[model samples]
Target: MINLFDTAKRILNPFFAKRHLLGDDNLFSINNILSKTAALAFIRAIDKGIKEKIEKLKDIDWTKDNTLPNFPKSFLDEYGLEDKPILLKKNIIEKNKLNHPDITEEEARRIIGNALYKPETILKANPNKPAYHNFISRTDDKHSDIVLLELSDEKENYEVINYHIINNPARDRKVNIHKKS
Candidate 1:
């Protein structure tokens, strides 16, 4: 479980770590440049990783009966130092079918499609719309906090299972809408 930023810093900081790289008059300026450079590098790495995950998911053979795949460890790993594997909530899928069988397939495809991009895409393209929703709650006994992405909305408040995050302050949240009986 490598911390992504920590790893990036370790790799990139040497450019700024040596005293020779810093200007005597303005150490603050040098530090700023180092931080910005490191941040950009980290973001690019993350974006690349996310794209890989999306491509992998796109390659799966989907069918009416086929179960959705779990989010790959490489992608979810961005969230934390530990492996934060994503679990697809089959029950929510079932409930979605029950609530609106007519639109279930379309919505499911929408989720898969919309999930292919970085969160920033939603932020820039559709600021008013939710970037994420709680499509499926993760159910790992070891990890209580699992991020469920809400991709799109269906009419009839079908998006209730979907929690908003894009423009909303709840962007950092991990939602578990399921109530244990």
Candidate 2:
């Protein structure tokens, strides 16, 4: 006996839409590429010159890359991300250190703020480091990744124990918050 639902699915299946045959890993790799694609587009939107640099990311096969698997199609495909981003929120976000899971968007300031703001200190401290100072052991001391450890019985899966670095751009990065006259 032929089921109507099954018949309809055969007619409307996404597999036939893009000539993409499905495998367990296939969807995941495509999702990874999709993420990169969206991020690259965002970068391109910010700068005309960046358009060319980000263009290389668009060439992904989608049927190949092997990174983020089982991504929500609705989010990645339709919206590219959350409508209300956790990272972009205006409120100060801190990083936790014990469990090591919660990575926030503000983390970039660790590098940018440090590079642009603390370049002198970095250079001064690492006089023998030469011009190409990438990172030092102090990076660990400066920033942390662990958010918090977990308990077996909590309603929430993980307890987020966010910790802000003492010298975070949020706190210490204030003297030059605005343009100087």
Candidate 3:
């Protein structure tokens, strides 16, 4: 089986290496000289590889009680929380699918898991709802941001109440979360 990452690195290494020599402005000019078909094929291979990875990560059964582990120490310490059990209720999962028909239930769950575990930006102590937090992370496509609302009353057990994807996190007024300074 061909390793897409290695293949991509091999193909892209030269372009990256030439950046210092050719300078940033002329670097991307190489693409204009390369065959468009090859570029399209490379993009397709990357897309397929990403989809396969996402499919593999869908092993978690969303219907059952799943406790996500490995809370980043920084996240835990900032929120004064522990690596406790977190639940994604079936109704919320169904609601997420209903709201975002572009993605499947498994994909929704996967996004939720990603946001919970590997959030790029977390907005804690939501101004409107003190018990709720917003965990924001990039989707697999990196074209959109997935935002998850986690509710924790006693700080022992948590539940994901809502989730949605924003097309542009930079322009989205609803996404108040910012990168930690």
Top-TM-score structure, candidate number? 3
Question: In order, what lDDT does every prediction score?
Answer: 0.39, 0.29, 0.57
lDDT, residue 133, model 3: 70
Report the alpha-carbon TM-score of model 1 versus the true structure. Answer: 0.35
- In candidate 3 the C-alpha lDDT for residue 171 amounts to 21
Candidate 2: Cα lDDT at 69: 18
Q: If scored against the real structure, what TM-score would every candidate get?
A: 0.35, 0.17, 0.53
lDDT (10s digit) by residue, model 1, range 78-148: 43223322333455556656654654444444445344233222221223444343332222233211124
The lDDT, on a scale of 0 to 1, for candidate 3 is 0.57
In candidate 3, which residue pairs get closer than 3 Å at backbone N, Cα or C atoms, i.e. clash?
A: none
Off by over 4 Å in 1: 1-31, 35-39, 59-81, 100-181
Return model 3's CA RMSD, one decimal: 10.3
Clashing residue pairs in all predictions, respectively, total 3, 6, 0
**Candidate structures ordered by lDDT, highest first:** 3, 1, 2
The digit string of per-residue lDDT tens for model 2 on 140-178 reads 434422111121132322121132233444322322321
**lDDT for 116 (candidate 2):** 23
Stretches > 4 Å off in candidate 3: 1-57, 124-126, 140-142, 169-171, 175-181
Give me the displacement of residue 146 in model 3, in angstroms. 2.4
Maximum-lDDT candidate: 3
Report the lDDT of model 2 for residue 66. Answer: 13
